[model samples]
Target: MGGSLPRSVDDLPLLPDLVAPQAWSADLVAASDGLFERGVRVLRDGEGGLLVIGDAVMRALAQDPAVGGTPVEFLTGRAGDRVRRATGAAPPSGAAAFDAFLRNQVFTMNAALHVAVRRVVARHLVPRAVLGMAGHAERVLVGVLDEVTRVGGVVDLERDVAGPYVTRFWTDQLGVPAGAALRVQQLVHEMNRMFLFAPTLEDRARVLAATEEYLELVGRTVAMAWERGDNALLGHLARGLDGIDLPGAPPDLGALVAANFFDGFHTVAVAVANAARCLLADAPAAERVRRAPSLVAAAFTEGARLTAPLMLTTRMALGDVEHAGLRIPAGTPITMAWIAANRDPEAYDEPGGYRLDRPPRLGTTFGGGARICPGRGATRMLGEVALRALTATSVQVRLESPQPGWVPGSAIRRHPAIPVVVRRVAAA
Candidate 1:
């Protein structure tokens, strides 16, 4: 279909209109497959930008310096801002701070800024540091599991277990006072909605409100840590930010906190839910994990490969690049369909199978290349802890329905309700 770049983006094949809405509510994987069957490795997305499918192209795009992390709007356009203004969703108070927070986030930065922020975040989130938190993560998960089993009935895994477990883990990890954990979780949850694929004015308004409060909360938390000399992750972050230089002036402490904590929580929570769902569905795998708890890590990795937490991520082209016999011009926005890439037949054998023996990072779930997710280590560590504790528990989970119910239109893949019946197994 491609000889040279299309004369215009409109000249390319268009993605189905329903892909975005259905992506979160239904099967994003199916939509990805449909694109492949039509031989649409690269297509024009009606919403905006060029949509890229297939493993090779997606990986090449992700790794290319010309294809970057900043959203196209920030790079070249502001359509969403125009729409928000037209809808009378005036800029919220602290809009400057909000914008700064987004710009400072590892996801939105590019070039020098991206490198600087990633370096700082990496120091704190390295695999060794994340692994050190394993004991605490295990305790949090075990407590949550015990509470869930004590209730003893049908449970929504996402709502009842994964959500609270993550909330508690992050709250503890961040050195949040026990009393404030719930509020911190609420603020992070609200802030996370801003990551949705396309938010209405109402959604933006809600996000603005939550982000404002969340920033204030971070300020107070940092202040308290300084006052008390709290020796937790938040304190480490606070100490770490001292005198750090960036492209612009250094980002506010709150921006750094939000960048590290909120982003990690979103993907990790989804990974936990997806991993748990996969384990519950695969009896032989679950049994093997149960027999050798060490296999829990592999099980978590396989689960993430099957259903990535983030279905897709968009990048703006810094310069023209050629891929698949097509010339993508500079400033063109490109959407990398990670869900499709993870399951690409060319990338994995029996892509649908729950095989733990596969090589590491075979999937695009956490993305790849220069912008591979910085929180990937932490995500896996947390997922492994949750799964290990689940296997060790005297509890059993079976799907109440054969299929899961997913949250609608979210940029992040999430299960709103994985209804499961729980039975406590008598200990041997």
Candidate 2:
């Protein structure tokens, strides 16, 4: 939000690269502090360079059209050019290559195009009847939790509850086959590597191979939608709604289907896990949620605020732009620091600590302004349902292991398998 991206590491003090894949949450917290303490809103971090932080700077990114026009057109998307120069292997194609032209298609289309597609996507996510939809998710989640507790309350919460719970919701609403949720989750993880810090040739090649299989699965589900014929997510999208025109609907509906699946699954699952982990840590909040089910939505937002599922986003400069008084030239690489902005002290009280009473409206956890995530409503609903169900279980959620064995990825902080034990209340 602060300024145009620094062209090179030399543009500013060689601040520790906050965007590096190996970099942990601690690194980001320290880096955010240094940037604000030193009064530099932008710096190139290790692995992934040229990060913009601070609330004022993020505001600049939102208001200025140049910073966000098309994500891949900017310096960040030139990994292929770098690959050709280094390895002599041809760059990837299709979704694997993270094609420059498609970047513009991803977000920065004309206002009309954004409106047309967004309407369709938003309908499923932010339904007119919130209580009705949330009730369905809650019912499904209760069934899932009952099954898990029946077998034994000891299970990997990340995989068993967070994922399968949401997966069942999609299946019920979209009318897809049962047990395909884990497969979708695996494919989305591979596909998301493209957005991480300069994915290696191996990563690109792997995604290229998976893209074929991934699209095949999306097609299978689309066919499944034909069988179900319900007004769920896949059904509604496959036939193409009346108002959405040709351009609004993707020529390749499978690809669009895959994209929509990607949008909600990982982010929502991670948010669910994070909230559970937070509530476990703060038992008081967990107990409060148990007493008042309505507080689940606020807890979900807080969980995302603490640990953003998608931490960093890359944007390119369309032309020379001044941010926080620094001139970033055309074609410079700029990384948007969603994680750092979420923790900005100016924006929230006790930004570091877990505060259930903290305002839910702060930070870019789901993004800000026009760039706000469309899946936000769905994410919150899924999380609320899952957490709400947990409160009713009359059990204590404790970490299976002392350590949070977080999975390493390009940009995403994933909760792959969280071993947790839920002690049931027999007296109840």
Using TM-score as the measure, which candidate wins? 1
Candidate 1 residue lDDT tens string, 1-428: 32234555666776765355455236667777766565556777765678876887788888888898765346323425543544656533435546656666777877777777677677787888988988888888778778887888888776678777887787666655677666766776776666565566666667778777876776567556556766566566655666566565345655677555676655677789889899878878888888899898889888887777778777888898877556788977788878778777767788878987777655777888878887788888888887876676576777887776567656667776788766678888
- Evaluate model 2: give its TM-score: 0.82
Per-residue alpha-carbon lDDT of candidate 2 for residues 1-428, written as tens digits (9 for 90 to 100): 34344544356644554333335333555557656665667665443446667776776676576765454344334656655654677766665323422432335443556556666666666656444678888777777777777888569886778877776676556555666766876775676665544456887777666656666675567666766666555666554544556453455544565555555665677678777777766778888888887888778778777778777766656677776456777766677778777877767777788777875475687766565677777777787777776776566567776667555534565655678876566655
Cand. 2 Cα-lDDT: 0.64
lDDT of each: 0.72, 0.64
Q: Which ten residues in a row have the lowest lDDT in candidate 2?
A: 97-106
lDDT of 1 at 298: 86
For candidate 1, give the lDDT of residue 263.
Answer: 60
Which one wins on lDDT? 1
Summing lDDT over every window of 10 consecutive residues in candidate 1, give the lowest-scoring window.
Answer: 71-80
